[model samples]
Target: MSDIKVISTENAPAAIGPYVQGKIVNGLLFASGQIPLVPATGAMVEGGIAEQARQALSNVKALVEAAGSDLSKVIKTTCFLKDINDFAAFNAVYAEFFNAPAPARSCVGGIDLPKGALCEIEVIAAV
Candidate 1:
């Protein structure tokens, strides 16, 4: 495991479970799922899917940066939504983070997310 490293940051929510925020292995960062919880207070954010998506992606960005990567270095992402109808709104918010030639993504709706959040996101980035 000499090539493995754990990634953590105060800018992102602390993990309350057995998992860490992210892990780097052989030049790749694999971040854990991030909900809309505000890292400073550990409280879920307000508003609809858009707000939640932004917060969640913010958490993801923090972890990615902590691992010596950026959103632009992301290779893939997986998003979960509580309602499929919110996909459009979430996509709009997602675009604000990932630019042209955005990282490949796999977003699924109608899934239960942590903290009663409307959305959650996890990422795989180059570190």
Candidate 2:
């Protein structure tokens, strides 16, 4: 087995605390949860759910690229949202990025998110 490689990128949000942005092992890249916080300032993007979802997914894309994989290679994903009602909006934006043979996904709604953000995303991709 190949040694695990931690992935990071300045284009994506820096992990708020003690954690790598993503890690690769055995031909798979596992990305940590991506919040809507902009990497340049480490602050949440100023917008609604759709915007937040866009930013979060963009961040996840960056991590995937940093891990030597691209969004098209993503096999699975987990999404967290502050409100279930916004699922359609989120899915709309999500569909723009991942279409056709969509990656397996699990999207859940919750009462809160870090920094009061509206969405967060994580992904797993085969390299």
Candidate 3:
């Protein structure tokens, strides 16, 4: 564990569970899944998947950058949706954050996300 370092930031919601926001090890940052809670108030963001995805990804960006990495350095991502039918809408919002050669991804739906959030996102990046 000597090579591991914890990462955190005030820009993202605090971890309400027994986990840190992220950890860097061997040049990689593993960020915990972020629900659509605003860091300032911890209130779940209101709206549908598109709105939720943006907030969740915003949290992810904060976590990733806390470890000195950016979205462009993300190598992979995993997204969870409360409803699978929201895939198209989720993708639309997601494309706004990631671009060409975007990180490898796996998205799933019907996830009973915490705080009843509409979306959640976790990432792995080169730190």
lDDT of 3 by residue, 1-127 (tens): 5588999899999999999999999999999999999999999888888888999999999998889989999999999888999999999999999998989999989879888888889999998
lDDT agreement with native, every candidate: 0.92, 0.90, 0.92
Q: List the residue pairs that clash in candidate 2.
A: none
| Residue 70 error, candidate 3, Å | 0.7
Report the Cα RMSD per candidate: 0.9, 1.0, 0.9
**Model 2 residue 60 distance off true place after TM-score fit, in angstroms:** 0.6
State which candidate, 1 or 2, has the greater lDDT. 1
Prediction-by-prediction clash tally: 0, 0, 0
Model 2 lDDT per residue over 42-96, tens place: 9888889888989999998889888887899999999998999999999999997
So what's the TM-score on candidate 2?
Answer: 0.96
The residue-by-residue lDDT of candidate 1 on 1-127, one tens digit each, is 5588999999999997999999998899999999999999999998988888899999999999998888999999998889999999999999999999999989888877777889989999998
> Which of candidates 2 and 3 is the stronger one according to TM-score?
3
- Against the true structure, what is each candidate's TM-score? 0.97, 0.96, 0.97
Candidate 3 lDDT (Cα, 0 to 1): 0.92
